[model samples]
Target: MNQEALTFRAATAADIDAIVALAESAYRGDSGRRGWTTESDLLGGRRTGPDEIEDFLCKPRSMVLLGELGDPPALVACAHIAAHDEVGYLGLFTVDPTLQGAGIGKRVLEEAERIVRDDWRLSTIEMTVINVREELIQYYLRRGFRRTGKFLPFPYGDARFGLPKRDDLSFEVLEKTL
Candidate 1:
């Protein structure tokens, strides 16, 4: 829970499994129910796979950041950031389900913004959140993101994204000016 106790670093190919596991635990299935971020009721199936994660790791101007704790360190938080022209895209954000709401997520977010702003030298950052997740939207709103009123239709038949449990699913674009 101590924000200072966490260390942040870019993830490598070796971290694909841990990142995928942490993402699954934070957003999918029964294990994700322990956190407020769980999408279990909205979707089913894998949140991410090794192939997708490896692709992110290999992409240029993209990074998978991991937040670790303890002496040798254990992956507890992670996010994917990618630069596209003048904007930075943020996704695959996860914090260990058991460790959610302890300010760790905030710290991880701050670090992500730092990378986007200072490292990438980008002036703006953007993300997509499920439109129905008001609480999650509010969380990002509190951190200075604003709804852009742009909606991306959820891939209904794509198991790669998830198995949508409802027909109303879609993503709303959120942006912040750094």
Candidate 2:
């Protein structure tokens, strides 16, 4: 696929199912193994389903943005953003397994940040990543997010998140001033 043919915009309610499928294929299940983002070794089951995606779509001041690839009109990537307290939260980030490492993820993130800063008038952006995901954390840190050492316990039984592979699993918050 020619990435030069890509386009991006806020997702519509009709795009929710495809976005959810893309998220699942990029993060979990046999389909995810094709991409480096897969957590197959650490967790299992659906990453985000239709209902959760609908919540992203219906939330006030929040969105699920999709990047459309050419020909097939597929959503190759997505991110969820919302205002939280004093900062905007970035979540549900995913890139099609085949599209990872080609700068698409970074572009999606930049757009997400821009939306928070320009659209929401937010001064900061924040997100939580698994504490053990050192490389992933480094990826964000390099993007200017700072480590606050603050963490929230990973929801053990919440399939909406993921099942813990180890006892120490949890989320460390990362923040950046936009």
Candidate 3:
């Protein structure tokens, strides 16, 4: 992909559907299997629904950032940034499955950190990765985030968060100082 042509901007309500679709493509079904970022083996069901994306976009302290490419502009990448008191939280990150290994996700994450540091004036950007996702965790660690030894229970009963294929799944918090 042409990194020079890519533009990052705040996602609007109109982009919610595409955002959800992009996320599902990266982590949900057989479509997700095409990407290295897929969590299909660990979880089932939709990665994100329209209603959830809508709610996220509606949060006053939160904004969904999108990376678009091409002349007509396609939603190829996205990251969610939200103010959490003194720190900034990043989540709902996604990249088009076909575009995954091409460094789009790295750009999205860098932009997320930029937003947190410049816009939110926060010193830290934090995120949580599924505990068993060691490869994913190493990806973050390479980008300056460190394991904080903090863990949160994965929402097991909530289908909105995706249904677990295994019994032991939790999130390990990772933090990067901006």
RMSD to the hidden true structure, all candidates: 0.8, 1.3, 0.9
lDDT for model 1 comes to: 0.94
The lDDT for every candidate, in the order shown, is: 0.94, 0.87, 0.90
Off by over 4 Å in 1: none
Error of 1 at 157 (Å): 0.6
Query: Model 1: clashing residue pairs?
Result: none
- Locate the minimum summed-lDDT window of 10 residues in model 1: 1-10
| lDDT top scorer | 1
lDDT of 3 at 132: 99
- Ranked by lDDT, the better of candidates 1 and 3 is 1
TM match of model 1 to true structure:
0.98
The CA lDDT at 11 in model 3 is: 87
> Best-fitting candidate, measured by TM-score?
1
Per-candidate TM equals 0.98, 0.94, 0.97
